[model samples]
Target: MTTPLRSLFDFNGGVKPDYHKDASTRLSIGVLSAPTEVPTELVIPLHQSIGGTPRPIVAVGEQVKKGQRIGDADGDVSSAVHASTSGTVSAIEMRRMPHPSGLSSLCVVLETDGRDEWIACQAFDHKLATPQEIRDYLRDCGVVGLGGAVFPTHLKLNADRQGGIETLIINGAECEPYITCDDMLMRERANDIVRGVVLMREILGAKQVRIGIEDNKPEAIAAMQVAVGDCGDDLQVVVVPTRYPAGGAKQLIRVITGIEVPHGKRSIDYDVQCFNVATALAIYEAIGLGRPLISRIVTVAGNVDAPRNFDVLIGTPIKKIIAACSPLPDTNRLIMGGPMMGVEMPGDEVPVVKATNCILLGSNKIFPPPAPEMPCIRCGECALACPADLQPLELYWFSRAKIFGKAQEYHLFDCIECGCCSYVCPSNIPLVDYYRFAKSEIWAREKEKSLADEARDRFEFRQFRDVRDEQEKSARLAARAAAAAAAKQLATTDTVAIPNTEASTEANEKAALIAAAIARAREQQVTATPQNMQQLSAEQLAEISAIEARRAEIREQAKPHLPPDA
Candidate 1:
């Protein structure tokens, strides 16, 4: 077995909250990997990643097998979405997304056929394929960061720049309370994870790799070490202190590599890259088995009698998953992620998307409401606990006062919303919530500014086009007038010398041709008859002749008594 790394570094400021992971880790995920029973329906959301939302490729009533692409990746920046199981598309309509905003978005509702059939899968030969080809393949395969970020994985495979990545860090910290999907994954599927790590390292062309797990997960660390035994000397399993939010990419990188990546700068700039263990497993499956990501391991704990981790389909309803967990009474709300950073879902019926790592059922007993807000006494507890080394009090004050510019100036976006600041604040200011509000307002304003710029550009273009059209029209009129004046001068002036007899003959010939054309046109017009009249019956012809004769006889009689002009 590979030996764990002894050298380790530390970062400034982090809290050690109750992990609460043991409740779900007691039993293996195998019992709930694939439930004996199936969900009646799977409402797969089209937008699951950080980039553009995948466009729906399946129409209503269309049958799709498991792992079949139901939503095509929008662009290189996006990831594809797939049918969780064999099913018929019942609707392509708006459904509530599992987010803190409780917003509804486009979803492909599927009525399950209960077959759980899969589409044909062929492994991608990354050895023979180019980097761009591999990225495109993974994007189509629906591979993304599964450790709650849900960033399209193919984008991270890019090793084209950043002075080349020398280190690849696999994050198995799972630092959030009550979330053990990654921990369980490393414990059971370490071999598969190792295979994925090798693939990722090859993709990034990294020379060395480090897998960092919290010291609390001894079993996971042992299993991963055993599996990684013969990989290479460059790859090591590093045990890190179990601290809340240590699993943050930057924090984990700091603890393992001593690389302090700033907010704006990227880890790749320091020749380092990080991936979650679950994300590694996903990469392995995509390149090895060719199966797209249609399911994930989700921890359903808190306010449940028997908390467990389940391998849930991407679009399976949370309520359906909860039904299996024997939810305890007084379960007030359903949270879609870990306690620290997870969003309280709008409803239990919200289907799990790719970002869902845990389903934290909340109640007053489990997560009691905070006491009434109190004025801050300039306490530095929040600042002390901040892992990013940011001043939480200043951010809180600016956000509360609606001073977004000051908040942003204070590096508001750097806050990871880990809830550490809020957890430690004596005044119970809900510091993270205020920070989140400021960030959202800033984003909304930026979006508006972008839209306004686009509209202004369109208006200016239209004005320019109108002016251009008018200028062209004026130029055309001037040219036409000049042409007419030149023609008149040419006709009036003796421009060419010719014999009188020849000129006369030419003029006569032109007149004769004009006359002949006009006569022919007149003859054709006169001969043209209405189709109805031309196809008259014999009785209609006879009736017309009799009427003509009667009219003629009447005219003859009237001529006898009329004047010569009449």
Candidate 2:
């Protein structure tokens, strides 16, 4: 077994609040009960992870089996999309995404056949595969961090540029209130988690492995300890203090590894890398069973009769998942994640995806609407509770005034939107909301600037090309003129050197022919002038008027057959 860590480090700024984890973790994870009116359609968003959205591989009307690959990774930093259940591809179109903005994106609609059949998967022993081969296999398996970030796991594994990792920290802290998916996974599948940790250790070539779980989860810590006993002396379970936002990657990393991840830098840059417990479990399944990630255990809690966790398929509708919990009659809001970081769903029809860990049903009684935001009193409670050590009041002032540059200057992008600041604010100011707005505004302006730069570049290039073309045209004309002059000079020189009677006669004949041709062309050309009009007689003018009248009549007659104006 891995020797236990002799000591641990600590980070600054955190709060203690009601965990409410027991409501869901009291029971074991179970499969979701199919609703009486099972949803016939499932909208599977391709861009669930943090990179390029997976490209659709299956077309409409194509039959797909459970765990079948439906969308392929589009880039190195992307994850694959799989069929959560056997169904026929009905539509691949834009649908509302699960975000606060409620924007639309490309989603694969599957009409369930209700068979839930499985497609054959090529499960390989990860121990037998090379590290590179295993990484590629995990990428195909659609493995990603299930700790709400949903970042691709393959990219995280490959972040170690020097191939020398000091520690691999597994974040099992689950510090967010009402989130126990990781807590339960650690308790029930500790051995599997340990197995995944061992695999990660081997792949990363790290000297030590640390799984940090909060002290509130005594059972999970105990189970993980027992599991680690069976492994070698390279892995241990580090029980961290129970605090809100302690589960954050940076905070947990600092507490477990004594390393501070500098702003704009990654944890891997400091000789360490982190993964969630659920992510490690996914890695283990993908490597050990050759199974692609199709589903996850989601915790459904708050304002429900039976609040519990269920093994939910990825594309199952949120309405159906909540049906299992029997929401209270007063339930009005359905949040897709925990209260701190969760986004309220536009409707129940939104489907579950990789990042969905909790579906919280909030009633007026459970989560009453926030009190009218009071003016900030500069109490400094928000700053004291902020895990990132940022000034929430200052950010609020800047964001409220739309002074985005000032907000950014205070390191606005570093705010994790963890809700710690908003939670402790005595003024009930929606501090996190302001931060989010500021960040989004900054990003929008940056995007606009980028687009403007691109347009300017294209316009400048066009101008350059036009000037270049004009210069080339002028050079070509000048060269042709010079050639003609040179030819004339050569002919003069030849004529001066040798004068023959036959040549002179030929030249005179050519000159006479050219003059006659020019005179004939001038005589045949028609020119309009007042002198020619005045020369016309009265009879000729009358004839011209008659011709104009006939032309106008013809034009009137052709109006019906003419094409309409654009």
Worst 10 residues of 1 by lDDT: 29-38
Top of the candidates by lDDT: 1
Stretches > 4 Å off in candidate 2: 2-5, 33-40, 124-136, 480-492, 496-566
> Across residues 410-514, which tens digit of lDDT does each residue of candidate 1 receive?
899988899999888889887888888889899999999999999999999999999999999999866755555455445645875433585664554455456
| Cα-based lDDT at residue 213, candidate 2 | 90
Error of 2 at 182 (Å): 0.7
CA lDDT of every candidate: 0.87, 0.85
State in Å the error of residue 108, model 1. 1.5
Against the true structure, whose TM-score is highest? 1
TM-score of 2: 0.84
- TM-score, prediction 1: 0.86
